[model samples]
Structures are given as C-alpha cells and as structure tokens.
Target: MRPMMSPPLLSPSPCSLLRFLRLCHAPRRRNPTAAPPTPYTFRRRPLLLLPVAMSSSASITAPNSVVADPSALARKVAAIRAAGPSKLQVIADFDGTLTRYWYDGARGQSSHGLLRQGNEEYDAKREALYEHYHPIEICPDIPLPEKAKLMEEWWEKTHGLLIEGGLTYEAIKKSVSDAAIAFRDGVVELFEYLEERDIPVLVFSAGLADIIEEVFRQKLHRSFKNIKVVSNRMVFNEEGRLVAFKGKTIHVLNKNEHALDMAAPVHDSLGDPNGSIDDYSLVKKRTNVLLLGDHIGDLGMSDGLNYENRIAVGFLNANIEKSLKDYSKAFDIVYLNDAPMRGVVELVSELCP
Candidate 1:
C-alpha cells in the first residue's frame, strides 16, 4: 500500500501574518484588564489536528492530526472501498463546510448572511439576532433540545423580518454580488469528480436555499447533474418580492436527512426534474455515506438513512479548545483551523478508486 501524502497547507493571510509579527516584535506591556491567554498545544491531546496523513499499511503518522479509533476507521474505510462508488453518496453541510470558513483575515459569510434586505433597519435587526443566538447555538452547556428550540425561534424571527422588509429577488442577486464569499479550495474539483462518477451528493444546509443556488450559479459558474440542495426556500410574489418561506423551518439541530420532508429540492429549477428531496428514493439504496460538516451537530445529517458503512468528517473551524473533544468523539475525522477540502478529495479518490 502506498503512503498517504500530507494534505496541502494553507497559506497564511498577509494581514494576519503582519499582525502576529508586530505583536512578537513589540515590547511586552501588561494590561490588567486583559484576560490571560489560553494555552494551546498539539501534543498528547485526545483529538488530533489536520493534514493527518494515513496509509493502508501504517497508522496515523501526523502528530497534529487525530482519529478517534484508527483501527476502526481503517476497517470502515476498507468496507466502503470494497462496496465501491456504486453504494457511496456524499452528504455535506453548505455554509462553513463546503465554503471557506476564514478568508483574508476575516470570517466568511454563511448563505443566509449574504442577504441585504434593502432595508438598513431590518439588516441591523438581523445582525442583532445573530449576535444573540449565535453564542447559544455553539454553547456546549446548553441542552440540545433547548438549543434547537432557540434556533427555531431565531430563524422564524429572521424570516419574519425578511418578509416585513419587502425583500426582493433582485436584492438576493445583488447580495451575492457584494458578499465576500468563496468555496474552500478543492470543493469544485470534488464536485466535478463525483459528478463524473455519477455519485449523488446531497448538500443539506439550514441556510437559505436560494442563496446557496446563487452561489453555485454566480460564484461557481457551473452546475452539476448529481448535486442537489435542500434548505429553507423563499416564496416570491409576482414582482419577485419575498413573500414567505416554503415548508417547515430547518434549524441547526434538525438539518439532517430526516428533515427532508420539510423542504423541496432546489434542483428542479435548474431544469432537472428527476432528483427531488421529497422523493429521492434512489439515494436511500446507496447505503454508504461520506458526510462533511463543520459543526458536531452535522453528524446527524445521516440520521434518516441506515448506512452499512459511514465516515463522518468534521471541520473544526473555530473555538477549537472549547469543542475539539466533543468533535473528536462525534466525528471519525476532524480537520482543524478551517482546513481546505483537498484532504476530502483525496479521501474520495482512495475510496472510489
């Protein structure tokens, strides 16, 4: 068996590099109000870091990388590979998973965050809602049920604001034009590879379906026959004004395939009538899954299907210290510091080969 090469390293942002260099060179000045810095180390932790290279004949050799159970993971991979691409499907989270988490020293925007409602006041209110509920969304102390309920509330309120703000479809297009959003490196190649192999990929997001499709159309500039998007879709009026949202709300917790009943597939508008989220019975037969997501809750994306072999890849984009252990326990593989999708593409090549 050939050795698994390390994934490509991400280049540091120039602005961030300059800031770090200045801090290192400047004189040490103590501020009483500043909180003590959190200690971060890669050694001897239960969870490992990214670029974790593994070979069929060898165990995980990357010091910073972690696999919850190397032997078990290898077994799972072997099973899936034996089953081959015929039984494989990819389920991915849209926002931070497929898209870059950080870009140019700043956090990238989610599908929902790319909107500009044309009303400054309403936009401000939405930002305020994000500020309040985002912490609860990520708080490990909060019970899952409670957090889910809060997320439902936040989505409902935000959608209501969008309706009240007289949002237009034109605004949605303009938002995408103005937003600083980009897909992670290698995502396009992954999609292309899967498409070539006739493998179905379900992009399940709790974000706006229209926004996600726009990203594909405007940003990606190409559409795949095998990719389908399921999310909260907006119902537009004759004038293309946002009127209401279709189906039930899909919050962070209920974002799995189980919630497929609540939303319709977004691919029909792209001139394909075969793949509908409401009735994609064919996908259920593919009993091996490769799930990609940024949040630990994303593991549930496969809850609706009973897969004989499954691999869950988690992207630990932020608050690593607070969530790494839980992520390690939940996911088969966890990529740290918003690692690119090249590792995932490599994994697919291995599995589908």
Candidate 2:
C-alpha cells in the first residue's frame, strides 16, 4: 500500500515564484529574422548550493525509493523551477513508465503484451518468446551489445508471429479495450497538465505505436496535440491488416539514435524559418528537459539533445532490491514498486503552476 503524504514543504519565495510565473507566461518569439543573436549552447552544471525543500506530498517513505544524491536532486529541482515550463521538453518511455506494471495483484499488459492476450495459440508462442528472450533483455550480467542483438531478434520473431496471427488495426483496438491495461495513478492528470500548458511531450517507446495510440484514444478520450508518439509503427495493407513495420526498428538501446527524426515535429514547431531539420539547434533552444522511463537503457532517451537541465525520473517497478543501485546511477530520482506518479506530478506542478 502507498504511504500517506508528509506535511507541506517550505514554499518557494514570493520573488522566485513570481519570476518563474513570468517565464511561464513569456511569449514565444516566432520571428527568426528579427534579431542577429549569438549562437546557442548548453552547459551541464552541478546542482546549486541553495536550500531545497522536498514537496510534502512528494516525499516518499517507501523503503524501495532511491535518491543517489539529495544535493543533485535538489539542483535538478531548482534548475527546473528556474527554467519554468515554456523552456522545458519532456521525453518519456511508454510501457512501464506511463502504465502500471501491476494492477490489483495481476500483471498489467504493455502495448505489445496486449496483442498476445485472449488467444491460446498466440499466448503460448508469446510465452515461449518471453522465456527465451526476456531474461537476456533484463539480465544485468549480459553485455549490452549482446543484449541488443538478442532484442532485435526477439522483436523480429515477435513481429513475425504478430503477422502470422493476423494482427490488424481493428484487432489492436479490441485487444486494448478488452485487456486490463491501465495508466499509473496520476498519469491522466499529468498529461492534462502538460497539454494545457502546451508543453511538448514525446512518448518514445519500443512498443507498437498503433497500440499506444489506441490506448490513448480509448482511455484518455482525446487526441492531445502536444503529445507525440514515436515507436515501431505497423504498416497496414490496403485491407487494413498488419503487413510490416515501417522504418528501421527501434529497440531499447537504439532509441537515442532514432529520437532526432521522431522529435522533428517538436523542432519544427519551434518556428525555424530556414525549414532546417536540425534537432540539435532546436533542442538547445529549449535547454531544459524532463526525462522519464522505467529501465536503465531508457536513460539514453535524450542522448543527442543539448539541454541545460535534465531531471531523469525512473520508475523501478520490478526487481526493486537488486535493480535500485543501477537505477540510482541512471536516474536522478527513482520511485519504487507500483508507486503512483504523484512525485512526478508534483514536480511538474512546481515548474508549470
């Protein structure tokens, strides 16, 4: 069970809060040719030596939670608060980070897992694949290069099975509707907050893009303009049946390389008059990022972006005792088990509100 919230932390000073509000309300400059400005750049700085207060509601008493360095965490919080939402970009993993790993003592289905349900034959084959590949995917003992090769092979075999099983767009919708797939607590609110503020959110996943879209459409009931999904998109035939996957496959480890193209729209919307596709320049202008994910590999989600401040919040949903150390190294702040996204929501609120 989740623990109760502690008392409220010391609020930001009125002056600092007002400054943040001004930044949030600052209008975007769309005229690129209006001024001859200096070239953009970003530098990583150590956390500030300022006094930091943990949000009363966000303070976790759970034994599984891990914050490797409280000073660094405070610095991230300060950096985010200082930059405000207008200058922020969020890149997140979909499967376990956004969705609950376990619900009501039963394992919840990921986008890919949802398609494997309700069919005995498919379930049997899926289980077999999991038994063969899942260990390699998660085994810390295996080297990443080897694991990457195995993961690609696993995805190839699974995609083949999905095609043989006659997976369709309609079938995906039905599966998501019938399966016990649910977003973690506070995810809906989090989406709403980002959407209302017009902050760009990219859901970068190795899961099926079609399934992810259906889940959002069916569950969230809105086509959020601010939220973009980049993953393995299924190519359908003339008759709307799954035929092949479009583009190069994006497995867990290679997400950073794939991110630039997937995040093009975000860069484009920043009003680059040259119509240039330089993701680096666009991202550098944004300068502050909030990254969220579930696995250690996910820490590379923002690999190419030049960001002034980045706060990686990781959800350690499985193997808590063993993985906490690694997760601590990968994420600035880590939440354990099935803990709701309250901490994330609170952090975002502090920046955007």
Candidate 3:
C-alpha cells in the first residue's frame, strides 16, 4: 500500500553518469574546464581473481576464515603456485640428488658408479685417500669446516689418481657401462615436471658430465632443454680419443665456484627472450631455487646464485641418525636413508602445479 516514489531527476551534467556515452557526431577539444575521464578503478570481479602470491610490495593481512593452518612452507607453496611457472628454479647435484641413495637395504650407488666397469681396480693412491679421508667424511665428531677440508683432500686425491693413471676415454666409457647406478624413484618424474612447467633445472655436479648427459638423454628421453649440466667434461682429440678434462677438474668441495661460473651464462640465456646469448655465457642469475643434494658437501652445489626463496633438501645415505640433526639445520629438508625422492617430488609438484 506504500505510495509510489516520484521519478528521479535527470542531471544536466554528464559527469554524474554511471557510464557516459560519447556520440560519433560530437567533437570537443581543449576544454580547460572539463574534468578528466572517470578514474579507472580496476576493480576485480568476484569470479576473476586468483589468490596466488608469494610476496607483494603491498601487504595487509586479513583474519583467516578457513581453519586450515598456513604453515610457512604451505604459504611458500601457495606463493610459488601464484607465481605460476616462470619464477621457479631448481639446482641439484647429480650423483646423489637424482641417482638413488640406497637400494634393497644396501648402500646405494653413485651415478659415476653406475658406469663403473667390472674392472674396478684398487689403485693404491686412490685407495689411500679413501682409507684416510673417508673416515673424516663420516666422522660425526669432526666439524663441518674440518670435514670440508678433508673432503677436498679426498676429492683431490681421487682425481689425482685418475690423472696419474691416465684415465682414457675408452676406459671411462667401459667403466660407465659396467657401473651399477640407477636413478632414484621419481627423479625422471621430477625432471619431466620441471620441463613441463618451463622451469629451469640445473644439475651442478663434480661427477663426469658425459656420463650424466648420456644417462639423462637415454633414460629421461628429453634432450637437455630444461636441464643444464655443469661438470668436468672430457677433452677429446680430433679422432675422439679422450685427452683430459675439458676444463679445470671439478671436485666435491670446490663445486660451488665451478657451478656458478659454468651455469651463470646458461641461466642468462634462459632468463631473457632476445636469444642473443651464444658461445657459452655463464652469467645468468635466477631468483628462486630448489636445491637438492645427497652429500653433506653438496650444500654448496647451488651457491653463488642471487636467490630469493631457496629450499634445500639433502639426501642422507650414511649415518642417518647422527647426520639428521646437522642436515636438518643445514638443509630445509633431509631425507635419511630414503631410497627415492618422494618428498622432494611432492614438494616441487605442489609448489609448481
């Protein structure tokens, strides 16, 4: 029974209109008194916006309505998801990161070990380092700095023996085929996923490059597009006989510098769109990193990068209980005696998916 309201008044001014329509026949210019066009609000529709952000220049927190706990890691995953595909990067060590750490309740094999020729000989010099420095490597009583020094000694001695023994291309190839190495479960999946997402995954290693590339190409079935390897490649003669290492030999302790120096250019090539990079530049920088390694010495594998959010996962093979605490403090995640990389694969998938 309410009385009808009177008709609303039509304003003479065009400024008050919700949406103003300009006629094709009308032409106006240089009206100094005219106001600017309505401010573009850029308002988001209810159905259009997605909440995926790792960090922002502007941040004002709101109370959570959903009870799902947002742990720091979960929030990181969310931010990466929002960042979508481009902002993520992975840096991993080859031997222990991708290759299995242990199998069938036995000490696992290294990638190089997979190429181990049945003629695995006992070199006195190499054996000496193994005997002397191997203890220091696993000595829980020793500090990391001390262990690092011993590791250098160990790696140097091992490489020195190879240099002295005149390791040949034929010998190395024969060794590789005879080796009993295998990839950790889900490693191929992890690599493929990164490739699928257009994320860069750099394998920085102290191992042999030719062997790793062979294994990757043969097993993973993807040419190294998403993958970049920085390692000690072999130098071959015109006839393809191995002469020596292509560059300065890579070792466990000195891997960081080599990794940065080698991978910097590749990162650069991937970072930009112009495609001018050629003849090998190693100066590309990345913002975010998911670093993986199996050795305690592997922590520095991805060092020297200007990284933003870095998540390091260490695969623990020997001395799990003792190494767990140290590895946990040193790495974001530690998989102790884990046969495969279920945890890492899961994390990457969640962050990137």
**Candidate topping lDDT:** 1
The lowest-lDDT stretch of 10 consecutive residues in candidate 2 is 33-42
Every candidate's lDDT: 0.75, 0.67, 0.54
Candidate 2: residue 1 Cα off by (Å):
40
lDDT of 1 by residue, 1-353 (tens): 12133233334345533442232232222212212222234656554333333223242121133467654566666667667788899999999899977655577889888799989999999999999999998888898988889999999999999999999999999999998788887798999899778888899999998888888888887677777787888899999999999888887888877666644444555665555333367788888899999887787788888777788988877677778788888888776656567677767876786
Model 3 earns a TM-score of 0.67
TM-score order of candidates, top first: 1, 2, 3
Residue 171 C-alpha lDDT in model 2: 79
List runs of model 3 lying over 4 Å from the truth.
1-70, 112-125, 217-222, 239-241, 246-248, 257-285
Better of 1 and 3 by lDDT: 1
* Per-residue lDDT of model 2, residues 1-353, tens digit only: 12123233345566655553343233222211112212111132232111111223343222134556755555556666766777887888988889877755577788887784346797789779988887787777788888889999888888888887777677787888887777776787887788778677878888887788888877766555566677887878988888888777777776763444543332233333444222333544666778999888887777766566778988877665466667778787776655566567767887667
- The alpha-carbon lDDT assigned to residue 286 of candidate 3 equals 44
What order do candidates take by lDDT, descending?
Answer: 1, 2, 3
**Which parts of model 1 have CA positions greater than 4 angstroms off?**
1-40, 47-64, 261-267, 271-279
Each candidate structure's TM-score, on Cα atoms with residue i matched to residue i, is 0.82, 0.75, 0.67
